[model samples]
Target: MFREVPVLPVVVPVAAAVFLILLWYLHSRDRLSAPRAAVALALCVYAAGVVANTVFPIFLDKPARSALWKVYLVPFANYEVGDAVTNILVFVPIGVLVPLLVAKAPWWRVVAVAAAFSLVIELTQLVTRNLLGGGHVADVNDLIFNTAGGALGFGLCSALSRVPAAAALIDRFRWR
Candidate 1:
């Protein structure tokens, strides 16, 4: 049953956002944690959506289309390797920024989140290809590289957070 299931990468973070928001509402007493979690969830979803939109079709044999039926274009050859590179580049920021922005998140937690995000995306592609007769092939490289990118992002964010100017800028964005 799982093998034939259609997985949508965009849906993973979307669902996560919805779940986090519901949890936040239910636990309104913990204002700090709830808000942080909500922001983290939103960032995760946004990053995932961007990655999916940019990289998903690179793995497809055919071009993905817009709502108006216009075909999307990839400047480079649409191939497995290109898809892998794009996916990794797209999600690294998610892995990095989420942890830095959410103060209490540990390094390990950030890694875990990145890994989960990558796994969900790969699984989604696998299921989508299997059920839809699409040519999208799930690549293990994507899982590795995407997670690495996220970890890299986390490190960058962590390092940047220490700079007084960067810290001040981030402080301005915090919800009151």
Candidate 2:
């Protein structure tokens, strides 16, 4: 049975508020240009979407199962290739955005951050699944694939930066 969980209804407004605050603070500091503002907005929207997808549908009624094996440890042991691909794709924007936001974001740093983010998502899922309601069980494969996605995104960003013309364009959007 599916229970409606009102996640976005709360998430969207909070994200918008944070975005507005960030825009205001940046503008006040004379750092908010059109490009930076666009990036900030996009980041906020993406973050909200991530939270919605990763941590919601928390059915307050009850959990579907009480099994202790929610944390899936084996990689590619029971998942399709498509699931792996999708996980990678989901994190690509993070890989691209971090370097744009930070002046000297290395590929390794991007991968590390992505892995940490994935870990947080999994932990949240594990906790909520056990306590408050519906959440995806933790999975080691997700962590591995999400980090790979971050690396791929950083590689794409690096390639674009190598192009003189594209580099010039991207420079305008660079935060630092």
User: Can you write out model 2's per-residue Cα lDDT over 67-111, one digit (the tens) per residue?
Assistant: 674789988789879989999999999999999888799888999
Best by TM-score: 2
Tell me the number of clashing residue pairs for each predicted model: 3, 0
Show where candidate 1 strays beyond 4 Å. 1-84, 172-176
lDDT values for all models? 0.61, 0.87
TM-score of 2: 0.92
Instruction: Give the per-residue lDDT of model 1 (tens digit) for 1-176.
Output: 12222337555856677767645653574545544555656665676575555335433333343233222234333447676677667767776566645657677888888888877776766655554434455556666777877888778777877999997765543343
Model 1 scores worst on lDDT over the 10 consecutive residues at 66-75
Clashes by residue pair, model 2: none
What would you estimate as the lDDT of candidate 1? Answer: 0.61
